[model samples]
Target chain A: MGLVNSIFATVQFEILRVLTLRRLSVAVIMALFPPTMIFWLQAGGALASPGFIITLFCGMVCLLSLLLWSTSNVYAELEGKSWAFITSRPYGRWSILFGKFLVAFLVSFIISWIALSLCMLVTGDLDFNILNDGKEVPKMQVWLALSGLLFLASMVYAAIFSLLGVLIQRRAMAIAVVFFTVVEVVFAVIPAVVGKFAMSFHMFCLLTHWVGWVPPSAGQDEDANEILQDFLNVYGRQDAWVHLAVIFAMTLLSLSLAAYVICKREYITLEDSQV
Target chain B: MIEFHNVTKLYKTVIGVNDISLKIEPGVYGLLGPNGSGKTTFINLVMGQLRPSMGHLSVFGMDPWQNDGLLNRIGLCPAIQAHYPFISGLKWVAYLTQLRGFSRKQSHQMAAESLAVVGMEYAMNRAMSSYSLGMRQRTVLAQSIAHKPELLILDEPFNGLDPKGRYEMTVFLKSWVKEGRSVILASHILHEVESLNPSLLLVSGGRLLASGSPQQVRSIIANCPNSVRVRCRQTAELAALVTGNFEIKSISINSEAEELEIESMNPLELLKLLPGLAMKNNLLISELRSSDDSLQNIFSMLMLIHRGGMRLPE
Candidate 1:
């Protein structure tokens, strides 16, 4: 019971810290970037397929915001010179890390849901007509399933980025940028077994398995079929359950590692009075 | 309540505290030293903020590093002045109080009470950035004592406070000591530490020069070099009389001013000898002053011993 109160205090403080007006502005801009781009592209007669909506809403909006918020939020206390005051109490490091991870995950989840929902509404893709394997899928079920996907992405990515922040605090920004560019974008699409290691690979896999692929008909032109096949193959490599399990396990591992690091290392803050 | 067995802390090439062993019982004990004299380093070691590089240290019979056993029983009022500018002092203290495992409601009450203890009750609702330096220091003190810790470790607690604040804090600390709590107060200011209590641990060059009552610390360096200026009607005769005395180290005679500046190994002895020597030589000793008994003088004496390889007075 005592430990629980410590963790709760940390969680409450994290919520307060992350929900500031400046951070809210960053979150707002993060959530709107993709949908606004989608609308602008739509004006130029750009494609508005299901694939397009998934990439815009899930890849750009959901994943990027989680990345942006999680990295800074983990190390924010130390940066602001508030770590000593908070950590010097009975509250241990495990409690502090757990609180930060929970806040990052929850905020990312909420922002992803709201932003993706807005995208669907504006793009006229909120149709209550999702059919899977010739079975009528309810509109409410589809909404819930999509919400679950957004939550999953936010949960996993936030944990990973938070772990990064803990492991390499001073270089968190540079390390995160390099990791996302190298692993998520470049290597995740290499069509090799090594590409399976990236989080984006699992994200694509989960999406493909959740929303079954509908191949373009044989009567269709080769160019259209080729585009559809490449898209399907890129995102349809593994079973959805496997992807879900991997994401969940990785989240647990990252959060645990982050807690361990916090507990062990001494944070030598530049707080001495130069007498 | 605290023990350090041959403990030393080194920051790469620089040594913060050297191999030193000592013990302290529960009372208000001052850790006195000038700037860069290992006062902060010793406080950090006791607070579990920095682990000793060699040897062992324990507080309340347990390793202080990451020890949650006495988390509620040890409070630290740090000297650093970092604070969140956006929040009121009440909110900041309350937040830290909650971190001590109190319910939010209980924390609120305790924080207000502690703030009141520091005479910040009226200003608790104001943003900390808008506060004067003394008010901010009080707020930090409130956070440390809000949990009702059994041992309070304060580092340079008198840095920015006015005389009034210092008096209030001194009173509160005396009352606190009277209640059977222990405090390890670190400060470079001599009279400030002296007012808290006569017992102090004198440290210099990362080594323990002396540890006992203030008088004992003073006795250890009794042979420290003293600078004395003597103005006489006949300066040459006084210098001639005092030049070969066993107490005097060096002498400089200024003819135009009719003064003799003398450095002595023992000022007290030289003072006793001066009047008689003047009388014997029939030289009128008009003015005499010894500028080597104050706080800074003691530190200067310690440094001279440290650098000049002079041992402490027996």
Candidate 2:
């Protein structure tokens, strides 16, 4: 119980620091970049599909910013030689990593959500008439589904990056690039079972099922959001619940690996921190 | 409070610490050694930051490596050159204390009190990066003591302090010892370690050479011969008088240089007797000093023994 509270206190302290005027301003700029760019493209009359644009923005810009922050959580300690402060605490290593991971995830999720809402400001009347001639799906449902996907993506990406920090903190930026380029982007873009291993794979499946273009049916509103309504299996491309479970499981697995490494490895900072 | 049995820590091809055994029933113990003498490695073993390549170590009767309970009872003020730039000293200490299971109110209160004790209360709100070296050292010390652990380990805590800061740290450490908590102070400087505690463990070349109070260490070296040099008009007379004393093991005089060299088993006693003897001989002792610094001699002896080329007197 004390450990849990301690973790929360750390997260609280970190989040506060992270949201300081200077860092928060940078976060806001980065978060709003996607929507601002989308708005500009739409104004230029060169915008193709808004869904594709928004998803790309979330995956690329939002994920990158979040990944950068989460990865830095561990590397910052190393670079600053402040790992002693956290490792020397009674709650120990795992709690420290978990606290960092949580703060990063929450910060990224909140910023991304704010960015999504800002996009709505430009997209206008997102009582969106994204129709494929099927039964009308409410705009509220579309928003809810997109929000869920964003939340899960934030969580999964944060965990993976946090794991990378635990594994190879000194090379965090370089490893992050390799992981993002190879796994999240290239693997996710390709249509293979191997892509299923990436967080983007589940996100793409969820996106497709939630807003996939459906075949035209008679006696249906022509300008309605055509979305799957199987609450448990919303994106029936594959089971959404199963994908959710996989993502959560991967988070747990990554967290466990991080904890194990932290507990077992003899970090120089820890050794030299002896008072 | 701490124990090591045949503990050896090997880093690939180099041995950071060699086979050794020790038990510390601590009030305050100074770990004295030069750079690369395994002081940090030994401290790391005690803190459970590293596992022994062979043998075993225990602190507070629990294994330190990943032992959260044991760690909770220990506080460390590591010897670091800098502090985190982004976090204020107050926040860092409070956050660490909170992690030690203290309530938010308690953590903050303890942090404030600890900072006050270290005379850092005025600048506690400032980011650590803004602090001067002395201030940073104080802040680090504050964070370690905020939890009020049973044992506190300070690794060269006075490394970068100004003279006044060093004096204040000595006073605080003295008071802390009076409070009956255990402390392990690691330092390279002899006088500094001597100032903190008479009891010490000296290491050289990754091996423990000596362990005892200052008086005991002095006694061990009492009969070890060391050279005393003298330049005087009456070198012959001075050498004759000095060599006659049992404390003086041998003597040689050079009339050409008006110099006298005496090797003494009991150098302190010989030193005490020199002036009296010189006066009796009516010798003008223009210059007189021991060429041998005792600390350096002890270290040389230890290294010799470590290399298996010399035997330490039982």
Candidate 3:
């Protein structure tokens, strides 16, 4: 109960901090990026396909925003000379970590949702009456499913970035960008067992399952069918529940590791006065 | 309620505090030292923000490192200034109070009360950037005291405060000590802590040079050798006369500046003899200066004495 109160207080402070005009404006600007990109693509006569939206637009925005907010959780306080004040409080470090993680996930997820809403409004993708596997599948349903998966992805990524912040205090953001490029982007696409370790791989796997991938008609596109088969083989044609379980486990594991590392680590903020 | 058992903290090649072993009872203490003399390092170690590189330290009978519960009883008004420009003093204090596990309403009330005690009730609603340095200092003090910690560790708490603020802070600390709570006040200036009449802990070069009451430390400083630099018309005559009559430790004559630097065992007695000796010799003394007046020199002398004791075969 005491820990809960501490976390709640920290959450309140974090919310107050985010609600400031400057920070809110930044958040709004970041949220507008994905929708603006979709609008630009639509103006160029490109289809706002579910696969493109899920993989490129929503995924990139979530990762970037989470990286921006979550990867500096500890570093920002240390740099601002507020770490001593906070860390000296009872249960302060743990509460602040959980509070910041919660806020980071919420802000990133909201940004993605706002971007999706604007994308739907600008591109008219909401009234998606496209057909899949001889059944009329609304693009709106696919988007909603993608949003759910994006929520889970945001939680996992926030935990991962926050853990990175704790582990690498000074260069957390730079290192996280590298991790994104190397692991999420490169390793996730590799056709090997290592791909399964990437959070993006499981997100894509779940995306493929939730939004049914309608294969090309028999004999209509042999090449496309082969490519689809190979892609499925790489990502694995796992059940949606299995992918969901994987994401849940990944989020739990990341959060647990972050908590353990944060609690054990000593943040030495070398201020001018400390000398 | 604090103990350091041969504890040392090293910052790579530089040492923060070296082999410091002492126990602090429940009372106000002045951790006195010059700037960069490891007073902040000692406070950091006690606050559990630092881990000793060697030996052991305990507060409230438990190892202070990572001891969250123990920190509930300790508050620190650090030397560094607060940098939250956009937030009001009230909100900042309240936010930190909430971090102490209080309800939102309760934290606000407690923050307000603490700010009021520190004479910041009016400007608590203003942004911190708009505050004077003294206001910021008081706000930081409010945060440290809001939780009513049993032990308050303040690092240079009087850095930017005016005389009035200093008096109030001293009064508050005196009352706090009277309540049986312990206060460890760290300052580079001697008189800042002298007002509180705290037990003195003189530190220099990361080592505990001396520990005693204010009077005790002052008596030791009195006994330390005093050097007086006298500029006079009869430099050689005065140096010889002073050396002959009094127990002058050393003398150096500077012909260029017409100055005679004299080290005296008893400065009071030498100062008394200077006028009569100068009148008798018909020497006009232009200037008189004492080297032991500055705080740094006093600490250096104490350090020398400490080193001498350490050099003795154990």
Candidate 4:
């Protein structure tokens, strides 16, 4: 009960403080950048298909959520020495870690939902007739299934990044920059099937097929029979569930390990020489 | 009450605390140590922020580690002055109280009362960033006392206070003891602890040196003879006459002033013989003051003895 109160106190304070800061406003704006660009490109006929646009937007949302929760919020808290005050409370260290994870995940989830909503509104891709009209529109059931999968994936991604934020000091910014600039771009260019290891890849795969916002790839029509076989092999088989389970398990393991490390490790003394 | 049975805390290759055993009962107690002498580490151990690597520690009859109920009865004011930058002092105090399970209204009331106790009510509504160092220290103290804890541990509570502020804190702490509450005040400023009149616990190099009443610890030093400075017109004759005749250990002439310092083991005898000695020498005595009995000198002597004892090559 005390741990719950402490967690609520920590999260409430963090959310309020983060919202009040102008830098968070800037981060929110940055999160919208990719979706906005995709919208403009789709309107200008820059994309080969609408399916690509939806995939890119969903991928960006996932990436933005990962970056915002892991880098901006985590770095700000560490620099402010707010964790010292939070950890000093009677709550166990696990409660603190879980509280931070909850805040980061919720914030990222909300931001992604907002971005997704905006993309849907701008693209006018929510029409149910598109699927019945033989436009290869994903069934509503598939969309719901994909949304659940993405939500779980986003939670796992946020947890992993938050743990990374705690373990590595002063690396949040550099990691975020490198992730967005080099790693994300490189992963995006790789074939979608090969991109499953990247969180963005799985998110994009689920989003593109579920929403009619983007059309199927050029080669997908030629290989429709092969694609169906592949989709069944990938999603119908137990491998996909295993992948989700592994990611969830990794998230839980990282969070628990991070909590253990934080609970045991001492804060560097003020008298020590700075790096 | 707090008890440490041979508690030791090591930080990697460094020794934060070593084989420290002591029992503290209800009353104000001062933890006197220099910087990096593990005062904060010791406080952390008591607060369960750090676990002991050896021996055992318990507060309020429960192991501080994994004991939330026991921690509920204790409060800590850390040495660092950093606070959540976004909240007012009142809100910070109220927030902490709420986390401790008080209702919002009760927490607010407690915050106001604690702030009043620290004499920081006027600045309670202001953002913590706007507070001065002394004001921040007072706010920290207010938060520590917000829950009316039985055991209030303050690490360097007097660090940034001015003389008046220090005096106010001293009076507040004395009142706390009057309520039968215990406080563990850690500070390097011996004079500040002296003003608190707490049972002294001296520590050096992660080792407990002495733990007892201030006077008891002061007596542990080798006998420091009381010295008297006397300004007399016939200083040369009086100095020569007083030397080697009346248990006077030594006499020294003040280089910058017309004064003589008479060192003696017995200050009462020296005082009684001063008039006769001055009359015999035909000297007019103007001023007299004794030097070795002050708390500062006693503390220095005690520290010297402690260091000397530690240096016996054990």
Candidate 5:
């Protein structure tokens, strides 16, 4: 009970610390990203397809927000002089990391939702049937499905970035961006069994399975659907539960790994080290 | 209580502390050293912000590395300044107290009282960025003592403090120790640590040179060769008289300043002989200064003793 209370206090402390105007401004910028991109696509006469929009929300808006907030959580404290004050408390180090992770997850989740809503507004896609091909899925149903995907993506990305922050404090942000590009972006899209291991793979699989989202190329290339279908057939289209399970497991694994490393490794400021 | 058994900390290539094995009992212990002498590193090792690269360390009978239970009994006022610009001093202290498992109300009460103790109650509501360095130091001290831990480890607590603030801190530390609690104060200033009258731990070059009561350490320092600089009109005559009467190790004359600098194996006898020699010879002595009292010279002499290059007077 004492430990739980301490953790809650840490969360409250983080809330106070993270509520500055600079951080809020960054959140606003993240919220505005997807809609601005959608507006630009519409002006260019590009198909602002549901797949592109979903990917933008999950990969760009959500991940960008996490990259800003989560990847620098530990680094910021150590770089500043506040590392000792918190790390010296009982369960202080662990609680601080956990609190930052929670705040990062929620902030990214909220920003992603706002981005999705603004994107929908920009496209005037209130019907949300753009993905279901006139099969008349209720607007709220599709909205909830998209919201679920964003929530999962936010959790997974936040946990992963938090681990990166702990593992490599000096270059966490740059390395996280590179990891996102190479692993989540490039590797997740490969039409092979190895792609299933990436968190983004489960996210896209759930998006296609739940929201009936198809690739933007499906309308232009006649065989794009056949290729996607062939790929899914070979991979065996699992249930939505399987994708969700994989994502949740990845999130848990990342968070646990971060906790393990943080508990085992000694983190000190350069000033302290040199002294 | 804390114990280090052959503990050494290596930061990649640089050594922080080397082969330090000691047991610290409950009391006030001043970790004394010059700048960059690994005093902070030793404190960090005790705080568990660092782990020993070799050997082992235990605080309160438990390994301090990731020892959450042990930390509950310890409070650390680190050398690093707090940098939360937006939060008030009260909130900052309260937040840290809350992490000690206190309820919000209790934490605030404790923070308030602790801030009051450190003479920061009036400005506790102001944002930290608006604080003077002394005010921030007071706030940092408040947070460390707010939880009333059994052990309070302060690294350079007197830094950024006015004389009045230093006095208040000394009084507070005295009271804290009178309560039977322990403190480990780390500082490079000898007088600042000396005023506390703490058991001294002198370190140099990442090694513990000596550890004992103030008198014990002072006695060892007293035996080292003492250098005295005298500004006098008759530099040559004074130098000649001092060399003949006292056991002088080295003598150097600065012709421009008309000063005679002398190193003596027995500083007391040399100092006693100075006034009479000047009075008898009508030599005007303007200034007299000793280098042996300084921490740098004391440490150099201790290092020499540790390296078998010098020995204490019999």
Candidate 6:
């Protein structure tokens, strides 16, 4: 119980510091970019497809939320050498790791939801006439599904980056490159079977189904219909659920292992750590 | 109380700590060793940060490695060349107190008091990033004593303190010991530890060379001559008489000042015979000082003796 309290205290302290330093402000501002741009384009009647705007908003929220939360809570802490203060205390190492996980999770979750809410409000106010193709999906249900997928994406990315923060010294650059070049782009181009391994792909597929992008006739356009069918099939598959579950499990496992390593390792001197 | 039984910590190709066995009682214990002599490693082992490769270590009747409960009663002020830039001095101390299980209100109160004790109350609100090296050191000291644990371990506590600050800290540490608590102070500065009058643990090359009272440790230094200075009005007369009567190693007279420096083979006998000699010579003795009993001389002698006697394996 004491350990838990200490961990929470540390998390609160760090969040307060990060917020005060204006470090997260830039990221929070960046989260609004996709929605703002989508709204502006819609106002100008320049938006090609309304469905694409929603997809862009969802992707942007997931990507930006993951990047911001991971950097602030995990990468920044390591670079700041703040762990030394926590590790020197009597609290268990697992408590510290879990505390950080909770903070990053909550921050990303809240920011992503806020961005999605704004996007929904803007689309509703504008009466953009999205989903007018005679496919009846409730607006609230669609928003919920999109939000859920964003939440999952944020969790997986935050966890992976948290582990990277612990294992690698230069974690920020590593996460940035991996997030942009590999997880975001490469996974989208891969086949459904292979793409499910990537967090971004699972989220993209899940959002597509919730938005009712599945076509009626299999012969209308083979490639488009096949992509839509793959989305529906993979979303319902037990294997996809298991993949998300595994990623979540690995996050906990990896974090715990890192905590154990830090607890036992001797910090020979403060001299070795530049931060 | 702390006990180490033939403990050894090895890091791959390098040795962190060699076979070290000692029992520390309730008082100040000075861990005197040069840099890379494993002082920090020894402290980390006691704190359970590092596992010993061989043997056992127990603090307060529990193995620190597996015993989180024992840590509640221990306080540590690590060397302060490293610190978090974003934290304020007060916040740093308060956070550590919170980790020790104090409530937020209680921790804040303790933090304020600890900072005051270390004479850092004025700088409490300032960010550590803006603090000078000496102020940062004081903040570290404040954090260590915030909880007032049964045992306190300080690594080079006086590293960057000015003389006045050092004096204040030494006095506070002395009083802390009087409350039946123990403190283990590690430092390369022998004089700083000497002021605390602590039981000594001397290490070199990752090995414990001697462990006992400062006086006893000084005696372990072999082949080091002890010198005594006697200041009297008739210094020339006393020097001439003493040289003939006793087997004086050497004598030097200060012509400008009335004083005689006598190098003796045995400092203990010289100290014992000083009053008698003063009375016989009818000399008004203003002062009598022994150079060998000083910490600087004792530390140098210990280092020299160890270097001459011990042989490291190639």
Off by over 4 Å in 2: A19-22, A125-143, A189-192, A213-236, A270-275, B219-277, B286-298, B311-314
TM-score of chain B of 4: 0.77
Candidate 3 local lDDT, A168-259, one digit each (tens)? 88999999999988998899989998898888878767755665543333222345346656898766688878878888898788888888
Candidate with better DockQ, 2 vs 3 = 3
Error of 6 at A138 (Å): 6.1
Q: Evaluate every candidate with DockQ and list the scores.
A: 0.40, 0.36, 0.57, 0.27, 0.71, 0.23
The runs of at least 3 residues in candidate 4 whose Cα sits more than 4 Å from the true structure, single-residue gaps closed, are A39-45, A49-79, A82-84, A92-95, A124-134, A138-150, A165-275, B101-106, B218-304, B307-314
Clashing pairs in 6: none
Pairs in clash, predicted candidate 2: A275-B153, A275-B154, A275-B155
How high is each candidate's TM-score?
A: 0.86, 0.85, 0.90, 0.77, 0.94, 0.75
Candidate 1: give its CA RMSD in angstroms. 4.2
Displacement of the residue B195 alpha carbon in candidate 3, Å: 0.7
Please give the range of 10 consecutive residues that has the lowest summed lDDT in model 2 chain B.
B217-226
lDDT tens digits, residue span A1-275, model 5: 66677778877777787689987888888788778877787688764355455555545788888898789878988888788888888767777778888888988899889988777677675233334443545656666778898899889989999999999998999999999888888888787877887898888778767756555642533354565567678778899999999999998999999989988888867876686
| Candidate number of the best TM-score | 5
What is the C-alpha lDDT profile of model 2 across A78-159, one tens digit per residue?
A: 6776676677776757667888888878878888877776776677753343453354556556666677888988888888
- Using DockQ as the measure, name the better of candidate 3 and candidate 5: 5
**Chain B vs. true chain B: TM-score per candidate:** 0.89, 0.86, 0.87, 0.77, 0.92, 0.74
Model 2 error, position A266 (Å):
2.3
- Which prediction has more favorable DockQ, 2 or 4? 2
* Backbone clash numbers for all candidates listed: 0, 3, 0, 4, 0, 0
What class would a CAPRI assessor give candidate 6's docking? incorrect
- TM-score, candidate 2, is 0.85
B131-234, model 6: which lDDT tens digit per residue? 88888888888888888888999988988888887888888898888888999999877778887789989876677877888787655542355678888788
Residues B1-314, candidate 4: write the lDDT tens digits.
Answer: 88999998887768788889999887889898777777887887777766788999988878886455666688788776866566789988877776666666787899999999899989899888899999999998888898888888888888888988988989998898889888898987767887767998987667787788777655453244567888877778778777846677788987458889987766556777787877776788888777665544545545565667422111
lDDT of 1 by residue, B1-314 (tens): 89999999887667788897998888888888877778777877776767888999999999987776666888988776656656789887887887778888998999999999999999999878799989999999999999888999888898899999899889988887888888989888777877766478878778876678877765654557777888997988788788766467788889999888998878667777888888887889988887565666687677667666676544
